[model samples]
Target: MKIISWNVNGLRAAVRKGFLDYIESEDPDIIAVQEIKLQSGQIEIPLDDYECYWNYAERKGYSGTAIFTKHTPIRSFIGDFHPAADSEGRVLGLEFENVYLINVYTPNSKRTLERLSERLEWEDAFLHYVQQLNAIKPVIICGDLNVAHQPQDVKNDRSNIGNSGFTDEERSKMTRLLNSGFTDVLRHYYPERDDIFTWWSYMKTVRERNIGWRIDYFLISDSIVDQLEHFQVDDHIYGSDHCPMRMTINLH
Candidate 1:
């Protein structure tokens, strides 16, 4: 099955920029979207054959996530981290017969590191949530993780060392996740590939120069690594600052 993860920046703007056309061309079985920046009635996405699940942030035009799948899941849940108040709408979990698919939009640490503490807390809570789900079944986690885990993940690593997304603390959390029996699928396939990135700065020539960061990912429990068929970064397809990252796995 082909699964794709993209941070669309804003659902409405993405549609105007040929988002549907791209989807049709890729034809992924499941597509996970982050940073949708829309509420239920604000925009209508014309996905004829996909079952759509959305988690909208309480604050309008802010962070949000959605999943569009060709096959309906056996069960789905909105939030697993904090039950009572999941106002940020960062996660959408879909349970199939074999695996639990989690589409996440991790909170950014902000340029000034103002939200670093909250982001760290979120990393802990989110990891706990994933661990719980993995205890039941293997988990497939995908979306914008918000941190570039290592120097290899972002261009100009030295310059970006202490930046929000590249901070030591943030990168350590990602390392912890990977060390906790999850495979970073893309890196598993292309361990030596360089200059391949997912999210680019919108500055005039950043994308052209390939000065980008691979913040988005497709991670799965180590037990399922052998089922992974293909892992890719579609850097050419772009609507938001972030492009699409995809993976294919044989569930059977």
Candidate 2:
């Protein structure tokens, strides 16, 4: 199955920038979206072939996540173990026949690191939440994790050190998460490649120079690693500061 994940930044703006056109072109089996920035009844997107689910933030025009899948889910849920952290509607989970799929939008620690502590807490709780699902069946995760986990993940690793997304504490959570039983799908395939990046600064000439961070991800349970087919960062597509990523895998 082909799955595409994107941090749209804002679904409305993204649609104006050709989001639907891109979807029509790629025709993925599943689409996971982050930062939808909309509330219930605010808007609707027409995707006739897929069943769509959304978790909207309590606040206006803020964090949210969504999933569109061709196959029916056995069950679905919003939020994680920590309901307080989920006010922003960051986690949305769907259970299918073979796997539990989660679309997540990890909280940004903010430029001044004001929210770093909270972000870290969310990381731990998120790990706890997914581990429980993983125990029942292998899980498939996709979204913008907001951290450039490794030096290879960011364009200027040294200069960006201690910054919000690149801080030691933030990266450590990612490391521990992977160790806990998931695989960073892209890195697993191209561990040494430093040129590939998913999220770029919108500042003038930043994306043009290809100065970006690999923040968006597709992570999967270790047992399903062999079923993975095509995995890639679609830097070529545009519409948001962050680009879309694709993962195709076999469950059968």
Residue range 1-252, candidate 2, lDDT tens digits = 999999999999999999999999999999999999898887778899999898888999998999999989998899756664468898898899899999999889999999998888888899999899899999999999999989999999999999989999999999999999999999989999998999998899999999999999999999999999899888999999999999999996
Which residue pairs in model 2 clash with each other?
none
The digit string of per-residue lDDT tens for model 1 on 167-202 reads: 999999999999988999988988877688999989
Score every model by TM-score: 0.97, 0.98
Largest TM-score belongs to which candidate? Answer: 2
The TM-score of predicted model 2 comes to 0.98
Taken over the whole model, the C-alpha lDDT of each candidate is 0.90, 0.92
Q: Determine which window of 10 residues in candidate 2 has minimal summed lDDT.
A: 79-88
